[model samples]
Target: MKVLAIASAGGHWIQLLRLMPAFEQHEIIFASTRQSFSETVSSYKFYAVPDANRWNKFKLIYMGAAISRLVLAVKPDIVVTTGAAPGLMGLLAGKLFGAKTIWVDSIANVEKLSLSGRLALLFADRTYTQWEGLATPKVHYHGNVLS
Candidate 1:
């Protein structure tokens, strides 16, 4: 199976990497905001998308377009992300391109779902929260990556 795994920098990226073992035996491509991250997953395909946050409309549009292009090119069977805004964009792109999408919310949001997480629940095929307390009927709790 071909899988596209994406995330923003820092904690989101780290959590995404920790899920790699589950994707063993598949062709996995990595995407992130930092070109420097290509070194982290040197064995697999990698692409860099422009970084953007909710507050920046122009950069957000640019980032979303870049992610859409990447999704169309990869045509992955599944798209998975540990997110900030970029990863949510990835899920939306993947969904539009006929891929199953999964979003794993960053473990840092302890008290509530992050803003992106709330939006992701509407689109992602499967949504996960690292904290059990955050799980709802639609969202799931499967422990955490950061320990």
Candidate 2:
């Protein structure tokens, strides 16, 4: 399976990386908003995308376009993210391309899902929360990066 793993920098990126072992048998492509993260994913195919947030509408649009193009080019079988905004863009693009999408809400958001996580629930094929209490009929809890 071809898997595209995407996330923003900092904790989001760390959370995504923690799940790397789960995709070890698959061909994985990594993406992050910060170029510095390239070093961490040096062993795998990686792409750098623009950092964006709800406060920056224009950048978000640009990121959406870039992610869309990347998703089309890679044509991954699955797209997964531990997100902020960039992850949302990837998930949206993945869904549009008919790739199965998984959204793993950041572990930091123990009380509630982040805004991007909630948005992902609208389209992501599978939505997960690290905290079991946060799981609902739609969102699931099957373990976490910390574990």
Candidate 3:
């Protein structure tokens, strides 16, 4: 299986890195905004898309175009993400291109759902929540991400 692991830099990237073991036998690629993330995960191709806040309309359009290109190029079997704008782009792009998508709500969102998590719920094939109490029809009790 070809898996596309997506996240923003910092903690989101760190959390995504932990899932690397789950797909060791399969081909994997990564997508994030930071160049250091690409350097750190050099074994696979790393894609970068714009990281726009809700205010930046132009950047959002740019990111959407990047997402389209990414889906066409990778054609992954599965798309996985840790919450953040860039990660959300990957999840949506993967779904548009016919990949099974799994989204992990950021560990930072202990009690509340982040913006990305809410968006993920609309399209993700499966959405995992690390916090035990955030029950919702879109969420799965996956236990703590660090555990």
Candidate 4:
């Protein structure tokens, strides 16, 4: 399977990395906010998209366009993210392009889903929370990267 894994920097990126073992057999393409972040996953394909947050509408728009282009070009069978803003953009593009989408909420958000996680529940094919207590009919808790 072709998997497009998207996430922002920091904890979101770290959480995504922790799940790399699960995708070992798949062809994985990664997207993040900075090229420096690529160093950690040097063995895999990586692309850098503009970084944006909920408060930055202009950057978010730019990121959305960039992510859309990447998604169309990569044409992945599945799109997965542990995210902030970039993941949401990937999910939106993946959904529009008919790719299955998975949203893994960051482990840091123990008390509640991140804003992106909540938004992902609207469209992501599968939504996961690290904390089992956060599971609901719409969100699931199978396992976590931390475990």
* Candidate 1 local Cα displacement, residue 37, angstroms: 0.5
Give all TM-scores, in the order shown: 0.98, 0.97, 0.93, 0.97
Residue-level lDDT of model 4, residues 23-89, one tens digit each, is 9999999999989988998999999999998888998899999999999999999999999899999
- Over the stretch 3-37, how does candidate 3's per-residue lDDT look in tens digits? 98988878998999988988899999988888677
What's the best-to-worst order under TM-score?
1, 2, 4, 3
lDDT of 3: 0.85
Q: What is the C-alpha lDDT of each candidate?
A: 0.94, 0.94, 0.85, 0.94
What is candidate 1's lDDT per residue for 1-147, written digit by digit as tens? 999999999999999999999999899999999999999999999999999998999999999999999999999999999998889999999999999999999999999889999999999999999999999999999799888
- Better TM-score candidate (1, 3): 1
Choose 1 or 4, whichever is better by TM-score. Answer: 1
Predicted model with the maximum TM-score: 1
Range of the 10 consecutive residues with the lowest summed lDDT in candidate 4: 138-147
User: In model 2, which regions exceed 4 Å deviation?
Assistant: none
RMSD, candidate 1, Å: 0.6
Question: Could you give the C-alpha RMSD of every candidate to the true structure, in order shown?
Answer: 0.6, 0.8, 1.3, 0.8
